[model samples]
Target: MISEATQAVITHYERRHEFRGDVFGAQPYANYGYWARPDLTLEQASEALTDLVAASAGLGQGDKVLDVGCGYGAGAVKFVKRYDVDAVTGIDVTPVRIASGQDYIAEHSVADRITLQEGDATAMSFGDESFHKVVSVECAFHFDTREAFLKEAARVLVPGGTLALTDIIPRRGVDPSAYLTGETTNQSQVCLDMPANAYDADVYADLLRSTGFEAVRIESLLEWTRIPFADALARVAAASEGERAEQISRMATRIRQLIELGEDYVLVTARRS
Candidate 1:
């Protein structure tokens, strides 16, 4: 069973149009697209971010990949299309997302190379060393515990298999307690109240090491990610009106404020050693 917070995250993606327009184009993906540079459009940035994670995974022909928390299957499809992977197996706790992802694979004529199923991150059903690479994008924060998910990821990966992802991290030394009392906290609680497992960058690296991963690389992408994402949200909000627009505006504002306070969006990659 999914936790309440995880359910909320799933529901948010199911109605993603409320915050972001059709980001997946003809495909379906559930994430705030990655914005690597200041000039790229929202869609381009998101795809670029996907490419970044895929590159970090170091995929090659005939490689089997696992996409944990694989949203609507867009990222898996994108991975196979962009890389030479033999197949991508994606899992998410949300049954609706799994169904939608399955539909997307069939609709896109990639069923042979893509599979999506409803599965948990903390305790996956896959056998040990099942994949050559494991990747996720912006979804692990919803897991009951990142440590458990990391252990599961290691268990499913072949020796030296890579694990790559983008994640949200609270800034080092920033007191979350301040968020409880500040006026803006209400607007930013969406980020502030992220799961306790959403640790700072250093702590996240330590967790990966403790989980049997090595060559850990963690990079801060605050300037390129949050700012551009907020800009995209603001642009969308400016073009619309009413409660939905207000909600988007608030989200955009909150992202900007979070960045100002040292909160970060990070890209993390490691190899299962």
Candidate 2:
């Protein structure tokens, strides 16, 4: 059963789905694109972020992968095509995204290699050791409790299987609750639903270790992710008009607020021990 918090998150995304294609480009990615270079378009940068996560997970040929919180199965399809992964099973709680992902999978002609289903990440249905790699991109913070999802990821992966993800973590000396309860714009308010246990880099690494993962590595990707994305959003807002422009402007503001709040955009990798 979906918790109230998870349902709220789903509702937020449901609303987002209406205009995500207009704002996030034609593809189905709902992530902060990794701006490897200044001139890359949003679609290219978004694909780059997915590639970064796949590389971090050490995805290999014939690997069976599980993507938790896979938004519209874009990353999963990318994994199968770009990384030569044998297959990818993507699970998400949002129904509309899953429906869209199914269409995306069919359109990409990878329906045989990818599966997108609506399901909870914190409690998965996969058997133990069912996958070789587990990945989540920018969606862990909304998982009700990221720690619980980590444990579940560990449970489903084969021994020594890798888990890689990008997440937002509060910087040292920052109080998450302050941001949660403070005044927020519409775009910012949607993200304030982050769980209490979402901790700093140090605590995050320790949490991974305690959750049956080892060789934990956490690297800040703020410069490549949120910073560039925010700049791009501002440009979009400036070039556009009407409600769409206002929405993009608010999103840019929210991204800036996160940066000012000392929130670190990080890429984390670990292996099941």
Candidate 3:
């Protein structure tokens, strides 16, 4: 369990938003689109999904997908509908997120294809080798330990299964404690009261390998950051009004602030051995 203090901060933060994961849950683009549009163009949505699907190439018609820290269940629902994958199970420790995702699945009639549960990453509630693909989109940051999260991920993933994730990775070689403190010590814009151990690309790769995952690949999200900071800022400022507007503006400001403090966006892919 996360520290009670941490959990309280997380609960407060998530309860404020309709979605669970911070803005840019998976793709900075659609993430940016909350303020940009209600009906994002298919083109916009597909680009974000390109990286998402490419990471899980082996998933087939009947394969199951496990999404840890599933956020609002966008990737989960996408996989079921687009690939006709047999099932998508999304789990989050945040109760509100599970509830919101449940409502989304029910409202969209994707209930047959998607499952959302209140679960933990450090101690997953699933059978060994239960899923063909495992994904945690920008949510693993909440995990208190690297080994715990990787162990649970590897335990539940089938041999030769794939794991894909896009989250804030520390810029290579930087000490996280330097910039992480105070408000950051609680719930910084980048992560929620989370001191990241797998932020470094090499460190993340090493952890995956140790957990029996092979061929791990970690890439810094340099290209994505260039356009998003400005776009996100502009969109939030333009779309927000009254209390909601003020909240979004503050959140957007914090995201950019964290990005500036550390070049911390990373995309990782690995296979369960």
Candidate 4:
């Protein structure tokens, strides 16, 4: 079962994105696109991040994938269209967004290749070795603990299958109270609540290895995080007005400070051995 706090976080995303159109509104990819190079546009960078994860997973035609924490099924749709994957099953704790995702998939006419449903990451409803690859993008921190999710991923993936995830991991021992938690410690968490589940890159890799996964690799792609986030904030400031603009500008400044202090977003991959 999804915890009340996590459910709130999912609902928060649903509400924040309710106004966006179907094109790029379902996912935060455009806002925080991965900048492999300086010239890439927000959409290009966002698609590239999906490509990066696909490369890490060695995805191919006829392979089945499980997408845990899939948000509104945007990334899953992209995967089916871009990669030749036979099918992608997406599950999210947020039930409200599932209908929207289903509508989008039907509108795009890719229903045969992608499916989205409301489900928890820690305890998924699937048989053993049900998928060839499992991917979760930038959403694992919301889990009560990554350990339970990783173990469940291992159980759901076939032997020698792959698991890939992108996450915003805090630097070890940093005071998360500075940015993650709100003005008060007991405040409701935001989508990017880092302190709620603090784990550095190394700790993540170690946990993956301990969870019966082998050849675990965790790479910090700070350039992607710092550049794209700054660019998005700049765009937000340019487009918004009043208190919303001010709020986003303040958020940009704090994120830059956190980056300088050693927090990073990373891509992690491993094989179930």
Best by lDDT: 2
lDDT of 4 by residue, 202-267 (tens): 778888888889999888887885656676666766777786676567666766777876577888
Q: All candidates' lDDT scores? A: 0.78, 0.88, 0.66, 0.76
Error of 4 at 98 (Å): 1.7
Lowest summed lDDT across 10 adjacent residues in model 3 is found at 27-36
lDDT of 4 at 57: 87
Each prediction's TM-score versus the true structure? 0.89, 0.96, 0.81, 0.87
- Quote the lDDT for 112 in model 1: 93
In terms of TM-score, the best-performing candidate is 2
lDDT of 3 by residue, 1-273 (tens): 566644754675465454323344343123322112334433353345444443445566888988877766666776776778899998877676677778777877899889999876788779998988887766566577656888998999889888887666668777676666646422334335556453678877888899989988887654454235445544755665576556656656666666666647666889899
Off by over 4 Å in 1: 15-26, 179-195
List residue ranges in candidate 2 displaced over 4 A. 182-191
How far off is residue 214 in model 4, in Å? 0.5
lDDT of 1 by residue, 1-273 (tens): 777656655665555533444633454654566665666766677778788889888977888999998877878888888796999999987676788789887887899999898888888999999999999998777677788899999999999999999887778887644442324222223322554664688899999999999999999877777778888878877977897678778878877876777577888999999
Clashing pairs in 4: none
For residues 62-168, could you state the per-residue lDDT of candidate 2 as single tens digits? 99999999989889989998888999999999899999999999999999999999889999999999999999998888887898899999999999999999998
Clashing pairs in 2: none
What CA root-mean-square deviation does each model show from the true structure? 3.0, 1.5, 4.6, 3.1
